[model samples]
Target: MVPDAILQEDGPLRPNLVTVAHAQYRVRAGALSVVTETVALTKALGRVLAQDVTATRDQPPFKASAMDGYAVRSQDLARRVNPATLKLVGESQAGRAFTGRVSRGQAVRIFTGAAVPAGCDAVVVQENTLAGEGTVTILSDGLKLTRRHVRPTGQDFNCGDVLLKSGERLDPWRLSLVAAAGLDRVTVARRPVIAVLSTGDELVAPGEIPSGDQIFESASHAVMALIKQWGGKPVSLGVGKDTKKSLLRALKTADAELIVTIGGASVGDHDLVKPALAKLGLELSFDGIKVRPGKPTAFGNLKDGRRVLSLPGNPASAFVMAQVLLKAWLETSLGMPPRQDYAHATTTAAIGANGPREAFLRGTCSLSSDGRMQVTPFADQDSSLITVFSRTDALIHLPSGSEAKSPGDLVDILPLDRL
Candidate 1:
């Protein structure tokens, strides 16, 4: 049997009334450093940067025309009391430069993105010019027009400027910027390697019919999907029986920086995970977080500095713990940004709290006719039920010590899809 001291709430961590921020701080402080590698820019999306990316050359690199028009001297157009006739000296297309300069009465036929020729102060759009024998006539007075439709060199960015800072997660748009800055490759933090295991003697794998006392397998695949969604590489460690020896062997052979065990974390006779982890020299960072569907959660670090997170066996509890705890811990360890998008909603019905622990009730949020955020909790919130979570879009956090909430009370909500 596991020692009572290891399973019981002692002095410093007693009361167990921890806020979300406090839990995140503890995980961050204990997170391990992520491995890194250099990958091609095409595969760098969704990966965090390991080093600062600098611009190799100025964007645009030259003064270019913004429209299809004639490049002319602004002073020459201003001096003319009447419409001026100028010769079309040459044409400047993208990627090809015009070698000659423009003189008086000479204008270059330029297209959009073409480099502006020397001595030309403005571009008279082709629409504003009338063509005749060997010359084009400027139609309007051209008073308000200025010299050069030129997009000056380095207008967007200068050379040696930091285009992207270290620790930024690259997305499609960020990749476009890196390509525009002449980068073909990028250095990114290696994906966090995670090992997933499910624990229970009553569970059997799918496709195999269980005996009269056995139930269908649970928690492993669902937890693996969540890990993938959060950008981690998952390795299946299979299911372990509810015994200390089996659990110990699973942890010993798993090759990952992080290990996630599903189920057998509560204070039940069958809860062998806590004892198994302790026997393997795992230091208890904290156990029993003050949250609903996840109150029995456990977090620790192996003697070799790897992380071990023990989540409740129920599918709903496993998912909730992964979202609220595992996501934040992995992101911070890998230098990824914290997800901060949350919506405020008015509760449509009354909600009662259990006790000191904060409860995350599954609910659907929508915009009302008056533009207020409205949230309606699902009828069933049992941790064992997974069907209700499919219909939920947000988790409504109920603060501790609150007995009940009436209609119209504001609640903090975390969106399901975004996280």
Candidate 2:
């Protein structure tokens, strides 16, 4: 009999997720062939920044009044018990500054956001002052003559300050910040092209009627949606049959940097993804992971240096692996740091003892009675069940060879789809 190791398709390759993640995804940081483009801020939303954005000018550019009141030289109003009166010089409204400087015993009418007139060190709110025809009296009642009502220049941010760093996603608020920084456009990383392909002749494309032995291809559709959400432009390669020729034809058409092939990664006779890709000179990184529902997940690089991530056929399995590994690739390709959303949550019930493989069980996280976050893993953890996956908001992570966990045991949880 042949030794199992000698007969193994991938030789002695078997690694946990950590080794693969660090070697391929994390260690090789920065970006992959980073192509930058100058896009209008209006259309920059959901795009990754390729360059650090600095402020063109100081925010509030001048010392302005924080309230609508009188801008005065504090010395004009002594700290005596009696209120001191000052002559009205000029008014400073927003966008209209008082050109003349404030002399001794003189006050300027300054509205909110107006620049503080020169030689003025304090602003008295209208509520704390008595307005007159030609003069304003500072009420001694509760008025403290100081710079409290003044907003110093560059209070928010100084000129040349790095408002947004590289690799930041230009969301709504981030776009607003850029606009405030006097930028009409921004330099951002080009969205990586991630081709989502599915395998097997038993899978029929959506919008077509499936035969009695076939089911609609759903994994690719879901993965495409996720890819778009993660800032990758996803293209569909449709369904490839079990034949090596058909699979090779479909694979050759994928001109993307990363091709995520769903299904046909196992050792079954119909499993032809690896064999077909091997014809194209695929160097396998690892044929299997030490994780349930994704043990068949495989990562490899072609002769042309393009990488392929093969996932299981089950929709739930494909989705989990995509979240775990595919997102890391997408982030690094876009020059963004790998997001680690792992958190600790107490289990609501006693979890069963885990086997040899690390498990990511579908579950919901909620606030417990004592205001603590708790996770409840679904009773049925069948990999093929998309219903359970749909209702799940978090993945309850259980390490390999872990003992059965009792209620209230803290377990690592990964929030799903930014939930």
Candidate 3:
């Protein structure tokens, strides 16, 4: 295994500057596909399936009614002109089918989801009925000739049909469909566990004002929330002071498949994450990415085959790196597809970029009158400004060699959400 620092050697051709695409490629290449198991359908929401879900039984299972109405033979109703009255035989409710077959001139009072009896080809809602003791008359013209509000068996799905594919995330609405297909459980991927540690000697937890030179702690919890949003279980390891022993102990004790350390990957003397990870026999992939606010980001692998990501102390940079790299890594580990909602949008303001690396800018994306997306960068693009990212819906990627983009220029915008 290669040490974490060995991957960052400055080469004449590669230049040691890591681009967003290259960082993502390296992270994805190390993804270990997690194991999977069957979970009850009720608990399967938000989980990715490990196996294709085939319908065990046909949806609806039988011809059924879709409305609270009267079931009748279309031929019997068609024989009468104007409002046609039919004798009411019996009532049919959901889960209990009307066993008696409907002959000519006969109708069954059926509620929604009730199985349609044999010989019935149409249904008329009860609200359109004019009742007279044993008979109900249709009040609307053409109602007797219309075939309405009747659902056929296997209309949704058939037995053995594929309902959901492997690697697909199941939502509550999708779980309902699985239940409709008579499946009580589903096979889904195990959720990835992530351990987060905040490292800094000058930092103190929130609720406690720094007595001397300490600053209020930030970034770890925020990054943890981002991990949760990406479908990973995040465990906060609290704060680790600037010491190799403390950092090393934290990395060794973490019970997660992925360990994240915030604030100690830089070259400062107090930054001990890199050396601590090195002492534990971790193979470093890269120590820095060629992006602003996050150039000091580091990645490595633990002795036990777990992955470790060390992010910058700057809150904004940490968040940007997490969104750009960690999100993709978690998705790949869970067998999910890459997010491709990135599109070109007209820039509403001029912005500068690093000449050699793509810059991700926080911007608000709005639909223009001409039905095009317009991305406007926040006035303050500083790496420490966390508020700017909160108000934005997408990240505007400014490619290399592009110094500044004027208004109306077409720039690539990656949508923050799947929507």
Candidate 4:
């Protein structure tokens, strides 16, 4: 039997004993190993860009009016003339331009987005003008503000200018910007397909009636939901039995960029995940982490280069581990920078010292009477308490070897769900 390699606080670092930081580094290092693909701008939302996108043409392409007004030469307004009245020579509407030039004492009736007529330098907003038959009167000398109500050529972006850098995720606004930049198709990182697998013969499908000794499978679904939320494509691979044969078959058949298995990662006799994976040429990176509620979490790569992360069977443990580890891995694969939402707050209640393993206690985060952020850890921290986990909005992190904390002690908390 292979000895379980656990990372304890006081012990020296071992190759097989992984700290959360070390595991995160491994995931980030391999994140850019995925392939890239070109996608239409219409379908690029939530996809990470694989290349810097530059503007193909200048925005506006030409000096254009920003308001429904008359385009006049600034010199026409500065002339030592009375009332500054200028004849309306022609009209310039959107999509159509006044081909004739505007000489002194002449203005073109232009609408918003209309190209500015040649020889014109500014626009007189209709609000500041009095319209008359064949002529207009400037009320406040709008031309004094240079290029007033005119969007200059390349005002928004210039041709060949880099509008977005590589590794930025495309959102609705970014997509709109890219479209405006004259790109119909964009190159982006291929969305990583993650296969979520739940193990244990004692677990049954969610809608099915469980036997006397069985529990409903849940963590895998939650994992899949999270993957989808994070811009990944999640494929569910159902439940794996306890036997090595079943587990091995499941691992071999999954055609995914990453495989996440829930359950059977500990040292119990029936915990056959490690042994089964070994039989299939699995190279273990870290068999265990130094964190509570997820100490049994394991990560490795298959011989074919697909990464595998195995989580404990308990619902709360599996969910927390996925949020901490799997989320980071997915972000890295998607060409996004690794990020976590952590908030520091004072504890509202006294807390005992943590054990050797780093502890992440589920808790509620709220504002105190003085408007300071505060967190209250629940009394029970059992890994099986799925209900408590569901209601928690934060994970109060207690590092290994931490001493008892008082009510006002500051703590780091990872925000969960919507904050």
Identify the leading candidate in terms of lDDT: 4
Error of 4 at 86 (Å): 1.6
lDDT of 1 by residue, 358-408 (tens): 677888898878999889877567778877887888998767655566778
Per-model TM against the reference = 0.87, 0.89, 0.89, 0.86
Q: What is the lDDT of candidate 3?
A: 0.80
Model 4: per-residue Cα lDDT over 1-419, one tens digit each: 00112112435434566777887777676554657999988888888898999988899799999999899888778844455778999999999999998887899999999999999989888887888999998876454556658899999999999999888888889999998987899999887999988999999998999999999988988899988877789998899999999999998899998899999988899899889888777887778888877878888888888888899999888988888888888888877766767789999877787667777888898899999999998877778888898889999887877777788889999988552
Error of 3 at 360 (Å): 0.7
Error of 1 at 68 (Å): 2.4
Residue 95's lDDT within candidate 2 is 98
Off by over 4 Å in 4: 1-16, 30-32, 79-83, 141-148, 339-355, 363-380, 391-394, 402-410, 415-419
lDDT of each: 0.80, 0.83, 0.80, 0.84
Query: What is the Cα-based TM-score of model 4?
Result: 0.86
Tens-digit per-residue lDDT, 1-419, candidate 2: 11122112233335444433443453244236678999988889899999999998999899999999899988767666788788999999999999988888899999999999999988999988898999998888525677778999999899999999999998899899999899999999898888877998899988899999998888898899999998999999999999999999988878888889999988899999999999889987767776766778878788887788898998888998888888777888888876777899999877777766667888898998889999988887778888888799998877766777788889999899853
Give the clash total for candidate 3.
2
What lDDT is reached at residue 200 by model 3?
Answer: 89
Query: Which RMSD does model 1 reach against the true structure?
Result: 5.5
